[model samples]
Target: MSVAARIAGPDLHETSVAPRSRSRMLALVIALAFAAVGGQLVRLAWQNEDASTIRVSMMSSPANTLARPDIVDRNGRLLATDVQMPSLYADPLLIQDADEAAERLVRLFPQIDVRELRQSLADKSRRFVWVRRGLSPAMAQRVHNLGIPGLLFVDEIRRTYPAGRLGGHILGRVDIDNRGTGGIERYIDEIGASEAAVGARLSARAPVRLSLDLGVMHALDEELAGAMVRYEAAGAAGLVMDVLTGEVVASVSRPGVDPAVYEDALDPSRIDRIAAGTYELGSIMKLVTVAMALEMGRSLDSMVDTAEPLKAGRFTIEDLHPLGRPMSVSEVFIHSSNVGAGQLALSAGAATQKAFLQKLGLWSALKTEVSSGPAPQKPQQIGRIEQITLSFGHGLATTPLQFAAASAALMNGGTRVTPTFMALDGEAPVVRGERVVSARTSALLREVMRRNVTDPAGTGRRADVPGFEVGGKTGTAEMAAKGGYRKKSVLASFIGTFPSSEPRYVTLILLFEPKGQDVTGGEITAGRNAAPTTARIIERIAPLLGVPAKSL
Candidate 1:
């Protein structure tokens, strides 16, 4: 620079301003520009960032994001959902005196345990602590008015059961932390992926439309509840389904719990009896026994020598009301003859009986995941005794749904449709089956089953619907406990179908441990309780299901 300056002489030096002054000016301008830029950057970030995310937390907890999806009935009526509420929390370190804060919090939240609060505060190592959840707006406002230091309020969501105990078992419940703990909640949480959750338009919307109808569900529950109260039943369960679609229109297990207050339920007996509990279905097995025999070659007119009780190794086969005369296949069903069923099953053989039952979808668990019901217990090795017991529904155990579907197979053109709890798409008859029997055989079986209810002196005369052409079979099974059958404890159930001339829907009703009353005619049979319930349900839902009255 000195050499170049010398070449230009004094002109170059004078033209350029003094170095000290130029340097100071440049430094000042640079500093001012940076300050202005920094201010704008801060303003932009403050305006655009999602403040809701940063409001209370930087490192968030899963509990903070806990929210449930919605639950709706088949008709889109809101059955269960969630609502946001204010929750009180505290920064224990910021609190001046833990004792003072505890005293004040107890005044506001009397339900809060003072000892627990003090203990939580004593652990000052904790940065934040939950004071209370599910706070009402009024209570939240009152707490906030206190203006206590270290106190904080956060918005928390609480589950609300809109229909109360109407569909309690189906909808299930969630824990206090806002996670699905049971029933549909657990179902959704399993399928609710993170992407689905984030892209969802509504806040925690998992609207599940079940096949349940509230009107039908309430009606069924009311009838079962009445029987439970009137007969002093230990418990009861009932189900109504569309025979064609395997769609359960109504299912009830009582005494039911209220989902709104899950903690109040103390009766462990309140567990779902139909879906979760399993039992030897008793004479109901006779339906499968007769179906298997007919499917094989034993005809409706085929006769079984029931003139004498069939003798086995040590156990002899008999009937509830054994006819001391030769009983035809139809008589076997009408009389509910155990000896006849066992002999018929033995003649049909275990392989044929197992194949037909397996075809009817009785060997495996149902596909519907709404309940945790056990699978139908398969016959052990299909022996002579096993075949005999299986024939009359003794050695085998099945869920009520399984029993219903198997019975439906006999009525619904011999097609085995997988039972579901979701509504059917339309009225179109979409069949899924392996053709367990020819349509001709099914039609013949229907005619014989009809005689069990419509004909006078039929055992199921109580299940007759005046103009509906009803047909069905009655089952009264003794409760099998850990050791053996329990005396005086019975599961009274009836399985039936309407328009038997051209069968449409199959219905079943079950009453567990119904008490005997003087009004019960000295008998607490399925006919007295479950059969009448089935009749009433059929009368009410038939019109709704679009089944027309046909001249028989």
Candidate 2:
């Protein structure tokens, strides 16, 4: 490295040299380490922002805010972190000519309004006008060479998501001040993890480890993105959660937003569909309905009348394919019989159905570290139509995150689950939440859920992963338009629990506005799209989660 290059970071104002006595040795070792990896560092903080190139400018503001602690995945992979970057600011009084300065700066940063910059520079009264914040090393060097008077660079701390867009929604974002703005970043601030009072250096505080496994998150993202392409879907979302602890191991929504890109977070299309947005979720909700029936003294084999369509005032409740005969409750779930589910709901009465849903925590909003999930939109009054439609996952809307949590509870021996994004250490107290249903009910639901996948004619048979014992349900609901549901545009979804005999994880996958492509035999149903997508994810992620595959 050149003497002058070592003296500065990228190209910024030179400062009194920071001690290089031991840093040179550290830099040499890092270079050797990078060389071992073919010059591609997997960006684990110090490894990426090489000590050889970066020099923290000895500049401080009156209030030099904290260098936020590093964020890592469950397996100690870097996610979000603070790296020293030079932020450009200006002192209006020092600028020689406002017009010239603005014109010169605008050449480097076209995004900066030349008129506004000129006015700010001309104002002699104002001192510390921010020219720009969070400039890359090369970009900072280009701006520094501009030699515009009054332009100054400070060694400000900036938050960076090194994993790029992977786990972006959950990693959250920070402000120009490195303060948490949204997602887990905001959660850190709420919990007082960002103690900025310490000097502006890397936080000595322990890295905030999240429950997200980078490997599992990457698998989930790749599969969901691929599903969108293969099925010609408008959007897709998926997540994997530990049924026992409600720890979300992997959650993804596409097209995903990069936390580093400020404007990407603002785009409506790029919203985190798993947690931030709510939908009717279609028939996967029948899992709750089935669980409720089991809790209400009904056995899986109990017969439910399904010979004719059930009426709820103006709307008639009918199955996609009616059996035209009484059917066992187990068959009802496997076939995804809307008429059977409605009959069960009617038999339980609206009050019972409403209370059962409340017990499962499906009626209210579910709050996690990432978001305060929007409350499910349900009928103002629990009339007959509302009761029947809700049983079949209509007339109610909920965040996929919330629905996943409820599903986890039913599979996890009926305990109420509170989903968390934080990694739970082995020593961390694992207190089981309140029981939502009897263990017997949970066992029966798990059995039925498994049967739904294993049954030859089951709606969810396509989701089966050999040796993984995948048990799941499929839902294909018409997307609601302004007036009524659009039959052509459907939301395909599947919810699965793996190693069904003893589920360790619950997975939920949703595909919005999927088209009837030739691959699906020109059908936009969850059985054809979402179910198979779930199988692909479970196949890849089961090994990552350390779940051994049993001989089928």
Per-model tally of clashing residue pairs? 0, 0
Let me know the TM-score candidate 1 reaches against the reference structure.
0.83
Best model per lDDT: 2
Error of 1 at 34 (Å): 19
- Which candidate ranks first by TM-score, i.e. highest? 2
List, residue by residue over 89-198, the lDDT tens digit for candidate 1: 88888888888788888988788899899778766789789999778999988888887888887766677888888778766777776667776666767777211221
lDDT of 1 at 496: 83
Please write out the lDDT profile of model 2 over residues 30-98, one tens digit for every residue. Answer: 999878786355455547556533443323344557667899999999998888787888999998899
Model 1 ranges off by over 4 Å? 1-66, 94-112, 138-149, 193-206, 263-267, 427-431, 502-504, 544-552
How high a TM-score does candidate 2 get?
0.87
What lDDT score belongs to each candidate, Candidate 1 first? 0.76, 0.89
